[model samples]
Target: MCSSFRSLLPALRAFTAKCPPPQICTSLRTYATEAVPDFEHKPSHYGQPLFQSHPHLLRPHELTPGIPSEEYERRRKDLMDSLPSNSVVVLIAAPVKYMSGSIYKYRQGSDFWYLTGFEEPDSAVVLEKNASSRGYRMTLFSNGKDSAKEKWDGPRTGFDDALNFFKADDALTIKAFPAQLRSMISLYSNVYIDLPQSPRKNARSTKSLLRYLSPPVNPRSEYETVVESLSSSRRKPLAPHIAQLRAFKSVCEQQVMRMAADISGRSHAKTMRFTRPGISESALAAHFEYLCSLSGSQRLAYVPVVASGPNALIIHYTSNNQVVQDGEMILMDAGCEYNGYASDITRTYPANGSFTPPQRELYSAVLSAQKALVGLCTEAEGLSLHDLHRKSCDFLRRELKQIGFTLHTGDLERVLYPHFLSHPIGIDLHESSYSDRGESLKAGMVITVEPGIYVPPTAQFPKHFHNFGIRIEDEVLVGEKHPVVLSVSAPKEIADIEGACQGLLGLEPI
Candidate 1:
């Protein structure tokens, strides 16, 4: 899809430059007609063309299956056991998103991925407690294979292979989901759905198709029927149960996460070594993600924040399009998702391969505070993010004072650090979002110990410190006694950072 679209881009630009908006659309349609004369553009269930015109959309699926079927069974059992007797749990996979002119590689819903490790999109899973003669079981509704659609979208693992590919007790076509729901809606007393994360009804198509079609008098959603069918039954959110199970990482999960962390760490190290003036923030991010992909990272864990200079003041700043100048610090908060596990590591280094006096002072402060808090990760049963977060705050307070920055707000005596010092990181970058078991930092749990001091141009700090942002983030694995730094391969010491940055130069832009 990307290659075909790229081929059309130059002509599309030419048409747009020479014509009005209406004419541009008309020319694109004509060009598309000529470009792919064989494309039938068969509409999907939602009326959009089902990616059939693209080559390699029919390519074989490639991935490292995250865990064995037994582990998936174990997870299902744990979740079912956590729920009340005779419960019904329904989880929907994330929909495949088409971004811009291309179909994005699908990312399965975290909850769905946790239970099945299935990567295909537009699939659904149902777990019923004591539904059959057996005590518990699972049924999968998958986008079963369609030879017609396979020409453009490639092969699919639908109903025919759902049982074999995803260890479901029974499998059915996703198109048959409504009928299945009708059959199973009243089977159990305790009904559950992952409603907290599912999409809302009446969602409009993004492609602007069907706007002229007459609207229905009373639009009904697939969920309304399920909810209205069970008037006398109790309904509950299944997220907490799933979250609880996901909180405690298994041996296999830890191994995947460690690999993810290591891959992400090496990407950061590469970014450090390649740092030089006149590089764009987008370039740095591309280089880092390229390194991650070179090391077998499947996709980015989240939108990377490659903020340089004052841009770092914006927490969650993902607009990595600015030019990195010499004598300025670069803050890169990025990670990659490897085999269903996620790694989030952020490192701040100098654009010129060296930090000035004020930059080093602030960077050292954040580094010290981060290390101090990481040492506190123990199996103390009751340790929560809140407790360690407070420790980070105190550490920041002292460090900021030593660094000659005045603290004023309740969070930092100022709002210099507008983000949390720590959070859980695993299958999701903020894996805690999917977890409801508890917030205790137990063994096998992976967390990030990130402490940073952002002195944007607006902050009332020393003049030299302005527009400089320094954040040292590392993935921390909760061990028997102390936290193990999984991302230690990314250097943090000032000498080490400088040494790593000064190693090479004149690399091609990503």
Candidate 2:
């Protein structure tokens, strides 16, 4: 504690407890516990002292390339070969916006990252298939340094260094895109662009990438609004093509996925040890994400679903602000994103660190079904998501029936378990590739096997399981040999989870 704080009032103690630099403020929560059941804790790391001060990104860090130049060249060549003659493809990087505070946190678009591995915002990529001239197939329009703009935005990958830094055949200011686009459109017969979906999201996506190219390009305008202005005819959707390429994982892609899975798996295990009756749902999320940040994950794949008790029955319940009860179960579905690739995993455990008999039974059903699905992970089987989902339904149904609950209606299974057994996961949490449920399993793909059973307190049947819910998810990699579980460290086995739950929580190295 700082000496200046001791002289001040106690209410302001929280503001100064970690005033000094390098003081690791590790205490999870100090607020008096509220008596509410579902919505109790609400603590985020807003005022905690800095663990370690991170200075502005040095020139060395900024100049360093994200991936090898050869890789990007290979991808562009492959995509070009697949395209018809006299065709042009355009990729727009993600847009930027001001935060409530002055801080600006930006990320590159997944598709753009896939094609170019370029991280700068307000950028566009142009790929002209079957180039008529030598050394002129690819081009980039990026933000260059303006003394006034740099004062506010910090830095830019200006045109001079753009060719070497991003390995683009040519580089120009973002302002030149409209002319470049027009010239390419006049020469090419077919044009490709990422078609907009969801008006609100679409608006933000297009504006951030194209607003810099012209005057009066408001940030709120929709993607179609911009596309209509750029070309005479409708541009075909380019995302599906990129998705096709991303669907099959390369060796480097798998390596990053494996790394992400390890970080998430270890975090789940540590969070299980941290769970107790008095701990809140938000606390668990904080702890898990804290571990992820320490482990060097760039960002979370999605919101952490720290659902406890009957709340698990509601899928995608992101309001993780509840007090975990002694006899209740905790269902957490969380993952981390690394280098634009995603790793997703889910784990269910007892709130008190040891499951009751009913919980064990429910968990066993999901576990057994997931194991059976894992067995079906071979190229010869050619099993699809629909196939795995059906198998999961059957397993849950058999388990429920054995426990003496008669699902009198055909819709009962749908009511209890609403989601599919698995979905393809890669750059996106639910990867854009293979949109259909009937898409067949293929080698070099990674997916999540999550089968859950949730019974709400309001639902009929055994009163003991009224608020009970259980789900066990794992990351699976489909290879030539078989499906490999990437997150193998997190304990899903009954005995292993129980043994871990019985010990004192390890606060550090979690």
Candidate 3:
């Protein structure tokens, strides 16, 4: 080590030792010993870092434009053909929110990113789908600059680069969106807008896009919320045409998602080696991001959940405080983003060396259910996400009964098991896709089959089961031949996990 690095080594070791051992970190807790090659004993750079994919995996899409602008022309033609001849479709990038007063993080809307690869915020895209394919054109509207703001926040792509680099037909200052919207709608008979399903301040772009279209517009929200509650502040309705376009993933999209899942697998394994009792949950979160950085991921797909103990019961827990308990299980629900695609994975494991009986039982129940459901991802026949979820729920119901717990006879499905077992996981954790009553399974789709059993902190259950919540999640690619478990590097078997913990205890971070 260099003189400075050598002197700082003690301090770094002290800091890492105080944090949870990397083996048990939420990102890597369930990774089997065999899944991660022993890198500690080897020279530092002999192999890629735990989370980094081989350079061979980083190649761009192979499909090339047949003609100079064929790809763009094809995309533009398809988009225009789907809408009315005289219609305008508007899509906006979601803005970032500050975690505190100054520090902030953000993720752009997948639909917006899919259409335009620009990563900037306060940006909106307008597609004028006109009578003739040749007449069709697209434009982007985004923020210019305020020297004071740029100095503090750093640089942005702005409108000029968006037009020249992103190749939008035209680019305009966001200040002109209102005037442009009014002008565009006057000439067009129909208007389309892409709006989020939730209430958002930055979603004002959707509202602005829709209101300018016309007086009467689509009234349905695009997001699924908590069981029965509806947000009064939900964004303006979605444009059907735009949604229809998003239903199918482009070849480039599938490649990006595949790469994201690959990187996430490594990150999860790296995190597994970092976990131990007495470590703060926040440090684990930091460890997750660190692995993502070590790899080529752009950012986290969503707010990472590093919940430990009873905090794990809170499904969306993001406050990663509290010292991990020796025997308690930590539930981490996290994802990594590359380019713009996302990969989500969740795993629950003991903070100590292994799981207790109750934890094992609950975990095994979820694991069996997940396995049974994922087995359906075969070329011969397969189930849809919602169908698999329902199957998992049925399995959970049976398992609960087998364990002397009965539902519905006493209103079980609703009271005991309330949440759905699976969801689409992509650019969004609860990503966009239909799964309500009768959606069918489709190939080339990505989804998460996460079956969780939440035994609340109540006395109705045994003390051993009280406050214990376990969820095992894997990112899966629905394939024609078989379902690909993208996060396969993480171990789910009880024996494998226990053995991994036993071996990794007291080890230093590699």
Candidate 4:
């Protein structure tokens, strides 16, 4: 307790004398509290539905319907893990399209939505990983909040809240995206992106952030331009990597796909019951779309093909304007999109509620082949799509021969079965279009099994069966032991289809 304590007492007394009093301190506290910005006042709406705003449509942790935020995070992590160190992944959002002055409905790009689940346009994401860190950093670039713009269009999840809302490491206004991307390209050793060429005509608004990045050019695409500007060897196509990941669906994705299939299948059944001899093909198509929308589907997956009589012989016949004759058959190929998933189904039935003798015979042959092929969509079968196609050709040839029509092996494939047997299905109607169909089927992979026989009026076939076309398509999910038919609700049996057309089965609205 000695000289040290005595020396500090004078300095402590001087410091206490200079400090503010209690009242002054209180005033200082009040001023500081008032100076801090208020962060609790959030916007009443956002570009997409949130659990807080739309509790009925979303759960607490879900980013999109049936897809949780954690899954999206995992997807990003998986992609980063696949790439080497010091690599960057760039993804762009889909731009809003306009037909004249009216705006068409907006849809996010499939690969972009698969990773971030952000449904807004004029946005982009950059994911970066360095050798020193085990994890990647996600930066989201979006529009900043503007009261004037928000008044005209709906609310936006501006850059200020994007970090927390989207679980991004950093967020900035989209205006800064170009500079940021250029900096990332210079710093990172590898760049993974997929930017297609933009069309010269029908350019987007000048104010759009994406339009600013990629202006309408003549021959080179946005990708080509980037490659020419930067080191082409350092850039890699990102789609094939993402496509491999999306090929096998998670459990939640499977559930969403099943719901999509159910909605579309039930709609097809309802359309069959509503069809009559005098109904126009266009009206039937509209009615089918109505049923799909009424039963929770967001929109049609693609343009529907509602063909009657000889029109069925033409593949991809979408001009549904013809009138149905009493004796002719109606072939409808349609599907619906639910949430982000899609479902495809096809059903051909008699317009007059009864098939002629030739119609039944041809339909039975195609139905038998389709049923057998669907069973092959299993891991245990160890068959690729090409294998199924060959098997289908054999089945059709035998069935046609049994039906009193002699067809050579080459004639069956060249003339009758023109299209491939199956294709992958998920987010887009033709999901992973670049994937090899020769690869063997794996569990959790969903695909379509379609078999059709189109007989034109020629000397090789009998007159009764001429001008008859029949097709049966269904969605199948490959399983470990057995295949699950997602579109089983749409009746395929001869008796069941006939019963549905005759109104014998008491079917309810989906």
Candidate 5:
């Protein structure tokens, strides 16, 4: 779809450049022998006839069997066990976002992905839970017009292919979602939603749904009434349950996460080797993405942070622009998603492949804090994120005091350690959890223990301390025995990182 649409764009731009807007529309309508609609009034890839051979719509079928039948059956059954009799669960995937006007790419919701494995927007899945039945009943709602969209955009899978290929019991157009809601809602007592908004309704389509459910007579009002009156009986919101499921990954999910970590780790390690005194931060950012793709990660789990020097002070710094200096540190907090699972790891290192005296001091503090926290992440009962987090702050505070950053002894101040030490990591980078505070670190849970010290651009005490930021992070999975760092193979220690810079540079000029 991307390749075909990109090809259509240049031709469309050329057509508009040579002709007036009205003339372009007339030419398009006359050639296609179709009236120009409101949507066609704007410049678009759809306006070009060169892409006629490509299909406009996408099919709701799987590329390959993503989840095995047994796995699907198992998850479906598990959901059934938790639901009440005559329960109906509505799951919708997230719609795509436009980069600017008329260009779109979307990330699917986890729940919707788990159930349907469909990526098409404006799609919804319905699961009927029954006490007597062994496997839950399933239905899918998708786009109707296949060939209609194919001429302008791309090919669609259509209902027949989606039902048979994806093993959906029944499939219908998105229009059917509203039409079928009357019966689907009346029959089932419970409706499950992770959030209030319907997945089938995008930013453009939701207003109509709200109007449909509004008090005034709209013939579709009854359908909305049924859904609204029974809205309180939603299926169990998987706040902690889904977190639990994701915490203890299946073999497949773990493999994907491990692959993501390896790719992301290599990206950071490569940056360490390739970075020099004059390289623009943007080039390094592009190089990091190239390495991520080369390592088999089709998508980055999140935006790559390539902050150099003082830019590292900004937590979510995405604009990789500043020129890295000889002695400044670069903090890169980036990761990739393998399959659908995510891996988030951060490493702060010198741009010149050597840490300065003050840089080494801060780096050692953060590393020591991480090491101390990891020791506490044992299988010991009753230890929670809150407990481990305090331990991290305490360690950091002690190290800082010893190094003369803070005058206070063991008591850490929030002005120093503001953010918490850890967060759950999985399909979502900052994955959903029960609470940010007091959440227990359970076995099978995966988290990132990142401790850092950021000294903003200032001139009070040490001049070298100003405009320098350092953070060391690793993904750790809680085991029955001990904490296992998924990113352990990556160069992290001061010695190991220097070794990687030398050895990796020896092979090729990455």
Candidate 6:
């Protein structure tokens, strides 16, 4: 054997020793004993697509589409560097969700994916700060290679490839993770973990690590269990630390987000042209999704709100079964997910090719308020989401009063504008949920500026504006001087929207 292969024999033997079953031990040993060149050239498969195999979807050295492996490494290093010495961070992957026997599409947990960039279910990673060195060590516990399982489901990264391809210092079968975590628990002074909560509704699958962690009685969480076992260590919530890191986007991340926005924006414009009187909302929603897929979106960001007429008055209305009427407005709040990033854009337009005077008046009011809120997204403005929301309420109140809808002192925020002005957007549609809305804006942050006015059919309101709802939303990236509107391709102006509906404004195919 070569010297390099000979040196790895000891660690390989140690890994094999941890295998729970004789068959698993044999499988792991076979990969470890193979020649390095043969292993490199073999037709091995991964849990997720890799650059070498899926070059059409990925560039060289990319772990995921549009994100290089080095960037994932830097994210891990940055997370560990922020923690105290002799710290250990544990992150668990999202479990595969099922509806009956069929499986829902798997999406990796955002925080876990942010750090490791390993896209597999039923896996966990531990980042141990080197007690005597400068850097940290990453250990991945993943599924062992099994021919029977591979034939049925798909290939796994397995132990040896986890070390070689994913840059993990050590790799072990997931069966050994509980024992390994217990052994390391006493050594670290600080433990940071983001544990999956105990399922309150449907129980998790037996293969899930979450099910393994969940106890039968009292239903204590994984976090609670880990905290109770620690005698001398300080336990910290891992989410806030990761959220702070995720709040600011890297240059490559910004590029991917811009691509996501463009895809969704163009899809929205196409949907606008397809809308017409007597069209069912559900059909319109399906057509929008079709356009997004044709333009390279992997999936819709969320269940789109394709509301028309009275349905538009209900915020978060997703029961898209109503047929649009000629003079009524259609409010379509939709976006797409591209390369793990999310884009959100909402536009309200007349079902017919032209808006009624009442509809145009309300649409203009919402659009003006939305523009003002987007302007405040810059770092120079130094405004928080709460501040911007207050500004939105003020802008809409004045605009509505000019349009003949007077509001009482607290009626504007309490009734008219029911939703917040902005939310951060990234890997998840609502990214960094733990982040503070009161915090000032930063240059690398991305948020949505959505403003709306929902009027009920009450005697206090003008009859022309009764039951009229109008909103305009766009994704904005905070900049040093001016905010960049990422979803600018989705037309929101009265003239442009009408032009798009009439198919005359040169709406380019995405």
lDDT of 6 by residue, 241-315 (tens): 898889998877887888777778888888888888999999989998988787667799999999999898899
Q: Cα deviation of 224 in candidate 5 (Å)?
A: 4.5
* RMSD to the hidden true structure, all candidates: 13.3, 12.0, 12.0, 20.3, 13.8, 14.8
Predicted structure 2: lDDT: 0.70
lDDT (tens digit, per residue) of candidate 1 on 1-510: 135644675787577587653311121112232344453433322211122332212112222333556687778887787778878887777755678979888777888888877766666778889745445788987667777877787667656456654568898876666557667857778878744322447553221111111121112354345445644436666777777778778776776677777778777877887778898999888899888886667799999999988888777899899998888788889989987888888888888888788788888888889888889887763577777877888888898888677766653635677777777877888876554324567887778888787775654667777777778888887877867787876777887677568763222223
lDDT, model 6, position 260: 78
In model 3, where do residues sit more than 4 Å from their true spots?
1-76, 93-103, 131-135, 143-164, 194-239, 378-385, 401-412, 433-437, 456-464, 503-510
TM-score of each: 0.79, 0.80, 0.71, 0.86, 0.78, 0.86
User: Model 4, range 87-143, lDDT digits (tens) per residue?
Assistant: 899888886678998888888899999989998878889999755353799999887
4 against 5, candidate with superior TM-score = 4
What is the lDDT, from 0 to 100, of the residue 177 in candidate 4? 68
Q: What are the Cα lDDT values of the candidates?
A: 0.70, 0.70, 0.62, 0.80, 0.65, 0.80
- Candidate 3 — what's its lDDT? 0.62
Which 10-residue window in model 1 sums to the lowest lDDT?
A: 208-217
| lDDT (Cα) of model 6 | 0.80
The residue pairs that clash in candidate 2, if any, are none
Poorest stretch of ten by lDDT in candidate 2: 46-55
Model 1, 463: alpha-carbon shift in Å?
3.1
Error of 6 at 491 (Å): 1.0
How many backbone clashes can be found in candidate 4? Answer: 0
| Residue-level error in angstroms, candidate 2, position 463 | 2.8
- Which portions of model 6 show Cα errors greater than 4 Å? 1-44, 131-134, 201-233, 508-510
lDDT of 2 by residue, 1-510 (tens): 234533454545455575752211111211123223322112211111111111121123222122345566666777777777778889876766567866455667788878877777777889888654332377998766666766665556567566765667799877666667767766777787864343574453443335543342333344335455544564566777777787787665676677678778888888888788988899999998988777767789999999988888878988999898888888888988865678788888887767788778778877887788787876678888888888888877887877756676754466678777888888889898546778888888788888887786654666767777677888888867677788776778876576456542222336
Worst 10 residues of 4 by lDDT: 24-33
Give the per-residue Cα lDDT of candidate 2 at 144: 66
Better of 1 and 6 by lDDT: 6
